[model samples]
Target chain A: MARSPFNADEAREAWRRYVSTGAVARRLLRRSTYHAWARCHDLGASPHLLKAEALSVSDTERLLAEQREFIAAATPFMAALSRAASSDRHAAMLGDGRGVVLDVVGDEASVRGPEAVPGPGCLLAEETAGANGIGSPLAEQGYVEFVGPEHFIGGFHPFTCQGVPIHDPQGRTVGVISTSVRRPAASQRLRDILVCAANGIEAELLRLRLERDVERVLASGSGSSLAKLRDDVVQTYAAARVRLEAAARRGPAASEYTLALVREAQRTIERFRHRAALWRDLASDELGMRQPFRLDQRVVEIVDLLATDAATRRVALVASMLEEARVVADARAASREIFGAIVSALENAGEGGSVEIAIRLARRERRAVVSVSASPAPGVAPAGPLAAQLAYEAAP
Target chain B: MTRERSGPGPSSGRDAERTALQRRVLLVDDDDDFRASVAEVLRDEGWEVTTAHDGEEALALARALDEFVLLVDYRMPGLNGGEVFEQMRGRSPSRLPAVLMTASKHVADLAAHHGFRHHVGKPFSLDDLLGTLELALRGGEPGE
Candidate 1:
């Protein structure tokens, strides 16, 4: 319903626009320095500024067409993480070394539809550590622990971001895993958790490469001549590309598709490394506590049904373990309550080991002491002032 | 895994004493006829119902009564939904579940500022309102 006195009507058109999708206002978040770095007036380019443009001859459209398959799968995961970081209990952000966010994930709906991948969303977009953690950590080439009111973006004074550089097997920094938050001291856990996750993924990638190289050597036969085997090694390296081609059919940008391809390839390769997945499972439980009610066992089973093969199953298993973890958590809380009651009972028994009307009045106030009302009163005068003082001392 | 309240448990028969609370619900709207229309439907659903004309009167009743749940429109003449929520928050009974009716996101934004647990967007029906009430007031489990 329209609340403004000027509008004066609670029509459906007005209602639907204001109420759906958990969306936030975009006009409030338009403070980015991406404009300074862009070489031209390309609406498609947000944060990325291509430095060596002289290298590509395909022009903007054709060159972007080639990279579409890569961006489709990757952009949204980064986007989802951004949205997740936004809800963090601490100050967090998604930025490059250049400056604060020019645009954000939630409002990306406005930039919908198929488009070429621009340089704006890539790691090269990074610069120095500002108030935002992403740029700062990237600049430092290591983990940074930034606290509240220490940020460069004044509007983001409420947030703290901690990003770790995502390196490929070659130890070259390829991307970043950052936690954007609004609380103090959250940067450490978020930073370490993400860094560990990214490392696990990279380890899986390296393992897969190793596996493929070994298989090729065996396939070509170890008895082969040195010259022939050297050729085989190069061929295997080329064939075992870790970057999978995403469907340009979804219309993602070049860089976006490339990131997706890398992630998907890593997931496929990661299945061979069962230990890494288990570590991720444990981290998921530790870091993702603020998520609202989790999927039930049946829902987890439903997820199991939706996925096919090893990579999909890896995603689904995380959901199943979360369900199992909840059962243990609930039981622990109940046992704690039971332990409290048992301790109270033992303490009552320890004091004289008997109960009567005289003893009842002598017990502490508020701790109702039971006695036989039917029995004749005890002959002894109950323990008084000094005993009361002793009982008071032990009351806690 | 079950524990019975037989010996040394909380005092017996506390549940039976709480049954006499007013089951009637007073839902206020500028649309008195529409309010009555819904009241008749609620009567069919077996609830005694009452209606108020505006936010100011609604807030007064919400403070004075213990049993009824208020469903108020967001954009009303004197004291809008946000004003009503803030004043109600002052009263001990403000935690009582409220169903806010709004045709815009601004209603949600305002309700969020005042800590309303839930809201029903317009183009909704009496059924939607009832479901939200069962959820917020009854603590009914939402879809798993």
Candidate 2:
């Protein structure tokens, strides 16, 4: 392969000058490249060489498991890029934002070379490997091409590399795609190829995320709509009943007859309102199941309300509380289930029994879980978990 | 020297009668029986009352009336109370004091959002309704 006219010695000279005089390497490098070089220096990385520190097999497996979705979405594009890299005797590497290479593909000779060869689980962060192709793009959050001696480490001077940062739907930098060639020259065409592949992967990630969201919505059904309709019906009936009673009181002569008729109509409307309210509550419960709520201050408020309720006055209620954390769940649904359990237990318990409820963060699961236990008076039967079943049956 | 009257006598009742006669209320509800009954009670109390069976009729009556307080039900058919009130506010040059009556516990929140002077929940006593109207007339807070 023909080498580019640009001399590698000039890049080395520029690096030496920048290191000794603390001057910017403007003519040979971009501003971002200089910033990356400074970051590497600040991180205490050696300018002459980098030690190979690959992640353990278990750590790599865990990372791959966590990023299964990303891998599934980017596989086809990565394969195509790998093919292109092989034709040029280069290597294509995909690394997470932390600069841990999750995948590497290319010709055996180029990928397995002794000097600065990256494999799966190899750490290429700027702090670890200095300002090279993967580390520079990861640091700058943009495309970067480093030729021969443009790399911060002298050991990497034999290879030319280009890299681009890949982003998720939210435009968060999630990973990097680095293409390295053993030849002295790195082409603009190579940089363009890596950028295109990154764009394709990002687009795929977005489509997959949207598909998952739509599926979730479809599974939850239209319970919220039904709940809203029931609310409207209940409101209308209540308004009508109020008006009928007022009319019955208007005239002294026909008051008895009018009152009797009003009473009949109100009885019918009241029955309908009661049924509609039940339906609304059920629908709301179902809707709550699909919704995610943070349990920070809301749990405290619910506990306070429960403590103030007339039903809890007869029993000793103890609540185990905790400082708030980022624990999210179907809080409304869960609360309804918990309330039902408590109500059942209290109703079944004999006079002078105590109930204990605990609301705390399950740190390992990263969620909030509520547990309730009731102790009945001597000779009284304990209430089972039948309340939750009843609640579920009642839900629309 | 002094005589106690059983009720407001002819001379003493004049001011009270005039105040009742001067007050006009536009009552809007969807149910025919409810509307008729409520309107009858308002008339018996000596106030001028106009009734509409639904939101559309309420808006039309509101537009034609020069001076009247609005007593609207929240969940009426067609435009519903809030929609009717919004349209009435938009079209009329003068702002009218409004009261929203509903069975929903969220009436207070609805009233706050829609700028109603008072909100009375349904199944309320006749005294409660009248008190709310009086409070609305005086531009006081929505008292229970």
Candidate 3:
């Protein structure tokens, strides 16, 4: 490894200037480091602090347990990184998003005395530990390094540190991986290693999550799978229906091929619809296993079933207004009324219109009110007969 | 496409402007066809809809845009809908108005647990989706 590019004397002078006068010396300090310094200063962190804060025993245990998967995914990479830097006298540290060091590996004495090595459970967040390897990268959610005097706290001044944030597949910075070495030992090689290790850990985390999701879906049994398939078939039918209806409204497409295609599409759609109806009957058997279910949940089922039906008519079906009351009614009857209301609304809903349904327990009347209303589509006339007819109400 | 005005009115113009502003929304779903189809319908309904295919894109958009109702799918490849909402809530000072869309049977409980005011089951109707968005925008919690 090569000596660090940063000048120790220069960094020391820059830190001195900023700490006393709050003025950053541009050419001497990195932009990220300057921002981190400003943040630490504003947070009232003591630059003279000698050691990082540690979490309580219980809190530390909880933090580790919560990060169990993350640790499992990252441990191998951490070990590899440690081995790669063993000759360079560097130690690797892992911290969660909050900058609590979760793990450390290799050559701890090379970076700091035993008391100052940010071992597991130490809080190295910028506000607490004052901008070192883990905290700086975690705070910026990016790559950063602190060489000697650039360290915000006096305790870390004898070390050079580099860190990179590790993100899950969702792009959330879940943790940071950092390395610390004796001053002048920092090199681009160490930064590259940190970056690669972080990427590896993230990829492993993604793989673990993918397996978990697959297991969850598989564990739910084949019924859920069939339900998913049925939903797709219904959505496809609805989309096809919408296109066919739109073409029909455009007047007879005089093209023979177009006419033939439309006919075949209609046949396919009819077959699919029939199959969907058969599936409904099959699903009813399972529904019987759990009778007297919540009406709202059953309504959700009907809405999902007929979702495409409403889309075929260019009508939006709004079921979010359904209340949370435990209305344990006959699922079949409730389904019929809700289905009838939605079907009626779809029939009368003009192009691009919406049908809003609300099922609320009429506390005073002790009857559940199933209200369905429709609003006109864009560029369409308002308050027409269909809109009026669409406002049908029923209490079942 | 050229759009025809039904009639001229200062009130109607104001209403249209207001609708466009108030109806800006972020639709996050991994399904390509479903996402595109819904976005088209919402646009036709006078909504300013922005679409993202996954949670990462959704979060980036949320960070960039100051305000918009989030219509996010419950089960995504990486971060689930609840996690996305949790991240947004953690990052911002105000509560972000959002609605959950899922095929799960436990949707109602999940939505309430995640602090979501409303939820629409998957393979949902356009009306249900729009209604849920409207409810979220209005700051009204369902089943209350």
- Highest-scoring model, DockQ: 2
DockQ of each: 0.01, 0.10, 0.02
CAPRI-style grade of the A/B interface in model 1: incorrect
DockQ of 2: 0.10
For residues A178-254, what per-residue lDDT tens digits would candidate 1 score against the true structure?
A: 55554454622234334443444344344444434445545666412221222222222221121221211112233
Model 2 misplaced regions, further than 4 Å: A1-7, A16-30, A113-116, A222-396, B1-144
What fraction of the reference interface contacts is present in each model, in order?
Answer: 0.00, 0.25, 0.02
* Model 2 C-alpha lDDT per residue in residues B42-110, reported as the tens digit of each score: 665555678887777877777667777788887654666777778888887866778898755567898
Clash totals, every prediction: 32, 1, 8
lDDT of 2: 0.62
Per-residue lDDT tens digits for candidate 3, residues B1-144, read 111222232222445435554666788876565565566556655666778877778888787776788888776556778888888888989768888877555678888899887788654445556667766876777753
- Candidates 2 and 3 compared: the better one by DockQ is 2
How does model 2 score by TM-score?
Answer: 0.39
- lDDT of prediction 1: 0.37
- Top-lDDT candidate index: 3
Summing lDDT over every window of 10 consecutive residues in candidate 2 chain B, give the lowest-scoring window.
Answer: B1-10
Off by over 4 Å in 3: A1-5, A19-23, A108-116, A220-396, B1-144
How many backbone overlaps does candidate 1 show? Answer: 32
